[model samples]
Target: MTAGAAISRRALLAAGAAVGIGGTLMPARTGLARVPAAFEPTQRLTLSAGETELRLLGPDRPATRIYAYDGDQFRLVRVPRGTRLEARFENGLSEASTVHFHGIRMPNEYDGVPTLTQPVVQPGGSFTYRIPFDDPGTFFFHPHCDETGQAGRGLVGVLLVEDPRDPAFDTEHVLCLKDWRLDDRGGFLPMSEPDGAAKAGTFGATRTVNGRVHLDLTAPAGGDVRLRILNVDSTRVMDIGVEGAEAWLIAIDGHALPPVPMDTLPDGIWRMGPAQRIDVQVRMPMEGGPVTIGDYRASDVFTFATIAAAGRVRRPRRGGPLALPPPKLPLPDLKAAEFHSFTLQQATDAAVKDTGLPPEDPLAKALIDSLCVGGATYWSIAQQSWPTGEARHLPPPLARMEAGKSYRIEIKNETRYPHPVHLHGHAFAVLGSSKGRLPKHFADTVLTQPGEAVEIAFVAAPGDWVFHCHILEHMETGMMGWFRVV
Candidate 1:
C-alpha cells in the first residue's frame, strides 16, 4: 500500500501492452459486452453532465434524454493504485451538482455532499476534485445533489484501481451493474413516487451493465479471469454468481479477502447491495465454452453477462491465485474501543421524532420543514430525519466523538429490506455478525442483510462525517445521519 509506484493510465492501456505470454492488441471481448476502452487519465480528466442519447428502445425510436458523465454509456475507469485521482467536473444539467467518490476516503473538503462539505456546483459551472487513491479495489462516482433524479437518470460510473503487485490474472472484465426506470421510446418514468419511497424504495424496470440490456464478453481459453463487479443500482440488491466455470471469491468492497472457492459458500453466490462490489475469479475450461455471470436475487435468475471462450488454450491448468495484497489501512485498538448501537428501518406510524434538542437558524429550519411537509418522510434512524428534506437543513450530530478514539457500533436493521450502509470518512473493521464470527475486512460500505445486525469497529477521525443507506431513496426519505469527530 505504499504510495508513488503508480503507472500512468497511458502505459496500462498501451497498444502493445505486454501480457503473460504475448503482446496483446486488445483486451478479449465476448457476448454483447465489448472490451474495456482506454481510460487514459492524463493528470486530470474533464467530465461533464448533459443529455445524451440512450438506446433503451432499440434503433427505431429517437434516443432518450438521460444525464451522463463523459458519455451516455459508462465504461471502466482504470487508474494506478495510490495515484491522485484528479478530475474537473463541468455541470451541464439544469440543476446544481457535485460528484461523490462513493467509497474513497478523500479529504474532508472534497467529500462532495452539497451544502455539507462544499457548495453545490451550479448548472453551467464547474468544480475540480482531487482524490488520493490510497487503497485499491472497486469504487464509483455519482452526483450527491438530487441523487434520486441525478443518479436515477444514469450519471454513474465504476472506477477501478489497478493493483499491479496483487494476484495476477490472464485478464479481467469490469462490470458496472445497474437498473433503469424507463418507459416506451426510452423516456424515463417518474424518478420516484411517495409510496415507493415509503416502502422498498423505488425499483427500476430494466436491468443493465455498461448501459446495455445484455452484456456480451470474451475470454481466452484455458485461462483465469478476474471479474470486477460493482452494483451501481439506486435500489436493487443483486445476488451475483458465475455459471459454466469454477470460481473463487477474491475481494469485497475493494478489500482483498482470503481466496475462498465459490463451492464452499451456501449456494455459490454473494449478496451485493447498492454501492457494494465483489471480485470473483473463474477458470475457462481447456476444451472451450461460454460462461454466463448471473444475478439470482429474483425468482427467475438472469444472466448479467456472457463470456465466450476463444483462441487456443494458452494455459492448460488454472494454477493457484497469487499472494493477496494487504490494504494499506490503520489499525484500531480493539481492547479500548467504545461501543454504541443505532437502528435504521422503515418508519412506522408510531415512530418517535427526536425533539427538544439544540436549535438551528430559523430561516434554514423553516425551509427544510416546508420541504418535508411537501415531500416524503418514509424512513427513520433512531426516530429522527437529518435535514428533514434537503441537505440545507443543519441537524445536530447524531453522536460526537473524541478524535483518535476507537469506537464499535452495532448497526441493526429493523426494516424488511437489506441496505448497503455507507460511512463517509473512514473504513471500519466488520468485527462480528449476527449469524456468526466473520472476517473483519476494511470497507466504507457494508451490506446488512434483512433483519440482521452487524457489529463494526473503527478509530474516530477528526471531521464531520455522515452514515447513510446507499439506496438513494432511503437516504432521501430518512435513513441518513451524521456524527462529528473532534
Candidate 2:
C-alpha cells in the first residue's frame, strides 16, 4: 500500500475494503515503493552508467535517475540553464523502468506514458521528476516504459538542452545513434515483448556510435566541429554519410536548416528512422588521421564513426560562428480541417498472446491462427486493452475545434509496421502523400510505412491532443489515439 499519487480502481478498493485485503475487492498496489530522495534546484547533475533505472510515468511515487548504457554510451548531467528540474529517479535495472523526455515540452503531466503519464516503474522502483528546461535544442532521453524492452536494454541518453541561442562551438559533438541485439557471444540483449504481438518491436543487429565499438572523434588541428546526431532506435532505418569531411548541413528533425553546404549525400547514406535528429558542420583535416562518418548498409565498408584529423590548428571562423534561429513554424490551416484516419491493424500470435507483452512470430503465428479460427471477435479501436495510454475518441462534442480553429489530419498505415507519426500541441505539414507527390516537405512526424498514407495540416491549437505511434511498444500495445481542441 505504499507508492502514492495516482488513485482510483474504486479508490483502491475503498482503501482495501476498509482494511482486510479480502475477496470482492482488490487493486491496492501503487508503484510498490522507493523514490523519495528529492532534489530539484537544478545544478546537481550526475548520471553515472553501467546499470540504470528511473520510473515515473504513472502512479508516481519516487523514481528517477536513468543511467544504463551497454553499447554506444549514456550520460546526461545537464542542469544549468534556467534549471527547475526536480530529480530523484534511480532504477539500476533488473527490470521494470520508465523515464522519457525525448524533446521535452513537459506537462501532459510529464508525458512519460506508461498507463499514460504515470504508474509502472516496478523493479527497483523510484520516480520523481519535475523537469523544465525551457526549450533549448538537440534533446533526448529514453525508456518510455518497456519501450521495446527498455530501449533495447541500453536505455538511452543524450539531451543537450542549452540553447542560449547556442553559437559558440569549436567542438560541440554529441552523437547518440543506436541498435543492439547480440547473442552468439556478444552480450547486452535482454529486451522482451518477443512477438506475442505489438507486431513489430525488437530490432538490433549491433550498431553503435556513442557507446562506441567504433565512433571516434578528435578535431583540434584544423578545428571546427559540431555534429549532434541522434537516432535512439526501436526499429531501424539508417543510411548516414560523410567521408572526407567538409560537411555543413545545420539541422533537421531538431529544426534549424539553412546552411546546406554539407554535400556528398547523394543518398549514399544518412537516411534515418526511429526518432531522428541531425545537425552537422565539419571542416577538420590537417594530418590528424581518420575521417569516415557512416556506413554498414550490409557492407559498404563498415565504419560507424571516425573523425580524428587534428595536428595543430584553429582556422575556424569560416561561417560566422552563429545562425541557427529560423525554425518555429507552428502551422495550422487548410480551411479548418479536422479530418482523421489511422488504421494500423494486425495482431495475432493469439493476438500477441492476449496483449501481455511478448509472443508471436511465424508470420505472427500464422496470422493468429487465421483470426481466431472460429472464436472471432476482433473489432478494435477503442475497446481499450493494451495500454489505454488515453484518448480513445472525442470530437463529436459539437464537432470540437474552436480555440483558434485550424486542423487537418489524415494518417493511414493499415499494418506492416512503420509509424513514426506523432503530434501533440503543434507542428505539421507534409500535405502530400496519399503515397504520391511528396517533395516539398516539412514534417513534425510522418513515416507511415506499410500501406502508407499521410496528410497533415495543422493549426488547431487548443490542447489535449496526442495521436501516437512513435513505436514505444506501439504506444504500449494498442497503438494509441487521441484528440481535442476547445
Which candidate achieves the best TM-score against the true structure?
1
- Write model 2 residue lDDT over 180-266, tens digit each, in one string: 655534444443333622466656665666645475677775667788877776666566677776676666666665556545444
- Tens-digit lDDT track of model 1 for 1-486: 000011122113321232322221111111011211343334677788777888765667657777788765663577888687667787776555678887787665567665446555655667777677878888888877667776777888778887888866777888888888788767777767666777776788878877777778877877788888888888888878888887888887888877877767657778778888888888877664698899988888878799888774555663665435877777788899888888986776588465433454222332221212114566777776655433445556677788789998888988888777899878788886796624567778888877789988888876657788888777876777777777
Each model's lDDT comes to 0.70, 0.52
Best by lDDT: 1
lDDT: worst 10-residue window of model 1: 1-10
What value of lDDT does candidate 1 attain over all alpha carbons?
Answer: 0.70
**lDDT score of residue 235 within candidate 1:** 85
